[model samples]
Target: MSGVDLGVFARCFPAQAPEPLGRAIADAGFSSVQLNLSAIGLPTIPDAQALADIDLVAVRRDLEAPGLRIWGLSGSYNLAHPDQERAREQTEDAARLIRRAPELGVVAVTLCTGSRNPDDMWRAHPDNDTAEAWADLLRNLGPLFDAAEEADVFLAVEPEPGNVISGTDAAVRLLDELGERASRIGFILDPANLVGETGPDEYETVLRDAFDRLGSRAICVHAKDVVTWDERIAGAAGLDFDLVRALHAALPHPVPVVVQDADPANLAAVRALVLGDA
Candidate 1:
């Protein structure tokens, strides 16, 4: 239906074991997933105990049993949390997952650059733009970057408006600051994040600019629509789906457009919307 591959967040499906989970995703007409361990009733970044319990071989077999590919793993943790101790613990867990990703034939792990807000990583805080927040982000990401390089995996950072790496410019700045470690970093482009108070007339321009700057560095893409600052949905009435399709087609290479924020009940509509068949 499209040149680009279509995927969905595994968390968008019901939580169950891997074998049945795979069948559910495949039965929903998707051949790809951005796997979140939580979808199968585990932490997003599993501990050694949980990790050891996983059967990598069976996981791969079952998820692919119905021809579903694991495009990437969800390794999100708060890199800039005000509580340094808690943040470090989370990073360590995520690093473990990043190091273990290759065993599942996955090469990328998605991350949130995170926020200064202690309770909510996704919520914005006045301090998020402070120098200290940036420093915390860099400090927290160091170990994960090391794990990624060691395992030959890419750390795909999503630029959320509410987070420290707030936009394309900030994302570019992070790469610059990483110096040698920048090679291990990449991006996950979600057009919704780039649109804030932007008028419909400027959606294409805004999206195009983002693509021009970050498209080369993108390892994944998220297809979702923004109805408000905090609300995201698939098949959103206000977002321009054709613009999403056109810009996706213009990408330098193919990347999976993972449908994020879709309700399980809206699976068919989200599929059609992302596939350009709506």
Candidate 2:
């Protein structure tokens, strides 16, 4: 079980407080964790926590009984909301996350591509393709990417099923648009996020292509077991861990993976399985 001090998605444990969340990672023998700021009502920019020094002194002292580390902090919000107000708020929030990135020892912050509808962060829409919608996403992210560069860390934009950059191709396109500046905005490739309910053949082909394009940009991935599309809303099967890890291992660059969709009750088991404990 050796990989980037791998950790679980703390947001999976919705019941725990921040301290307990950190403690859970420690108890699982994980060296680090990826905090989901949106899940816990913590925005990255201009938030109260960003304005003041994060009181992680308590977490630092209490969460570690033996050994533990905060690899990075995350504020995964919709950066491309169709509503100007929502986009403004979320874009501003990115700064708050960046402010805390230094103390958290994070080299990058994770983010979502964002939904087309301001009121719906996870729903798919047709207009997400509109130039205006894309412009909105770019208008905000451009500054944040620069800020992340200044922070000396990368801002990883993750592809989601219902967002502007839903698949790897778009992610690649976005990177191409950035040119050399793409180095500032990295990637958090979650295959499941890009995948829809598709046949195994389709899934494999799509995922392989996705990785081929963005593998070099990946800082991390979200490991999850998902069913194929034909299996209904929650059907299909999980890609073999050995296969998943093998795909990641074959990446041009190295990256750690957080099991984003795992259940909290089975963190240790799932973590070990994903990274190949044997």
Candidate 3:
């Protein structure tokens, strides 16, 4: 664990102000965080006036003052919206976020691969698997990748169960499509998101295979655990800690493991579990 960083999603402390949020995360024993820019009063797309008006340096100070490192910025948006105009807006916003990341001292900007459901980016729809949906994803991401390359920041793509790029194979295929631009893209491996109603006997095998497929490209890991398709929880979620440890060990480089989708009060316990101290 010498090289690995442990973090929590900054949104977990929704009720607190930026300074208090950072302090709370540090108090829970996390040294890093995946920050939502909005929480710090930074617009995802800062207009010329906003660029001048927003004091990002001060924002960084607020987080760092509490001993929390900003590992990445959450720039999640609907990249695969059925409406082309709406999707274009989302991509442009992402480009803006990408351009501002380096100044914030962030290593990557995490994103949703998106869904065909125009109303809900996380909800699954049949059209998500269609050629048109894939094309839309490619179309939106192409310019976004160019922006990432110019910004020199990595884009960490997360694979949720219900999105255009929902699985390890689809994610790898998208990376392959990007070719050289793929260098700017990384993976956020959330083992719970990868699990899909596998029986008790097959859970470990399923998880190990996913790690084998995606670990090398993973830059961050989400620390939520899943018991079944519908049952996700903090801590181990009934999965073996030994298996999780092994998977982390297999990564080519140590990356931040971020705790997500858990109650704020359980953060300390989650941190301990993720660090193998619980």
Candidate 4:
């Protein structure tokens, strides 16, 4: 992690507005942030009206004022929700974000492949592996891909164990299906999400496999530890940061190592662990 760029999830800071939040992240020694519009009281996937309310210039000024910049925009709506209409709505919202990503100076928009459990997109369901779920994902994803193409932004999908794109194989399949449009898609690697219910014994193997298959296309890497599927900051749980750092260092191109699941109190400790400065 020594030569890697370090960032943090902006929402990890408690500030309700952009300026203070940027200050908080900079103070913690991070130079970039994966921003969620929710950090400024707007929906993550805002509608046209809400999107109109955003002041991209103000956001950029506020964040850069504190030496922090927006690296990625969180666009994580459920891409495969059982309800097609609800999923479509989320997709349209994400499309809006993708179109405006350049204005915010963000290079990518992050996504979740989603789940069939109507209540929570993060909860796993048997149907998540079914053909219909795959169809739902593709259907919802098409428009977002178009938006990415038109806006020249990368759609970085994060593989969650509970979602349709649950592992490296699924991720690979999706990329293959994208064909030429595959160039517009990249990945966000968070080793903790790959761990799922598995214990730390699977950490290195899982991390290596994921990188071997997806590392070259990685646009962002999440720094969090796993405790039997639970997520925490680096070194606070079971994940092996040494292996994580090695794989990150081996990436063909540099990507931000964005720290997640950390709050102000422990942010400094996580930063040190991520940078191998601890």
Provide the RMSD of all predictions against the true structure, rounded to 1 decimal: 2.3, 3.7, 2.8, 2.1
Q: TM-scores of the models, in the given order?
A: 0.94, 0.84, 0.90, 0.94
Best candidate, TM-score-wise?
4
lDDT of 2 by residue, 101-203 (tens): 6655676777667777767766778888888777777777876876687678888788776888777777888888878888787777777765665666677
Q: Candidates 1 and 4: which is better by TM-score?
A: 4
Q: Candidate 1: what lDDT?
A: 0.84
Cα lDDT tens digits for candidate 1, 85-112? 9999888888888888887778598899
3 against 4, candidate with superior lDDT: 4
Error at 209, model 4, angstroms = 0.9
Candidate ranking (TM-score, best to worst): 4, 1, 3, 2
lDDT per residue (tens digit) for residues 1-278 in model 4: 55567999988877578888788788888889999888877788889898888887788788868888799998998888878998888788889889989888898988888999998888899999999999889888899989998889999988899999998889999999879888998899998897777767777888899998999899999987764212344324577778888898898999899988888888777787767776
Better of 1 and 4 by lDDT: 4
Q: In model 3, what are the clashing residue pairs, if there are any? A: none
lDDT of each: 0.84, 0.68, 0.78, 0.85
Collision pairs in model 2: 44-96, 44-97, 45-93, 45-96, 197-229, 198-229, 227-235, 227-236, 228-236
Which regions in candidate 3 have their CA more than 4 angstroms from the true location? 1-3, 41-52, 227-237
Q: In model 4, which runs have C-alpha deviations exceeding 4 angstroms?
A: 228-237
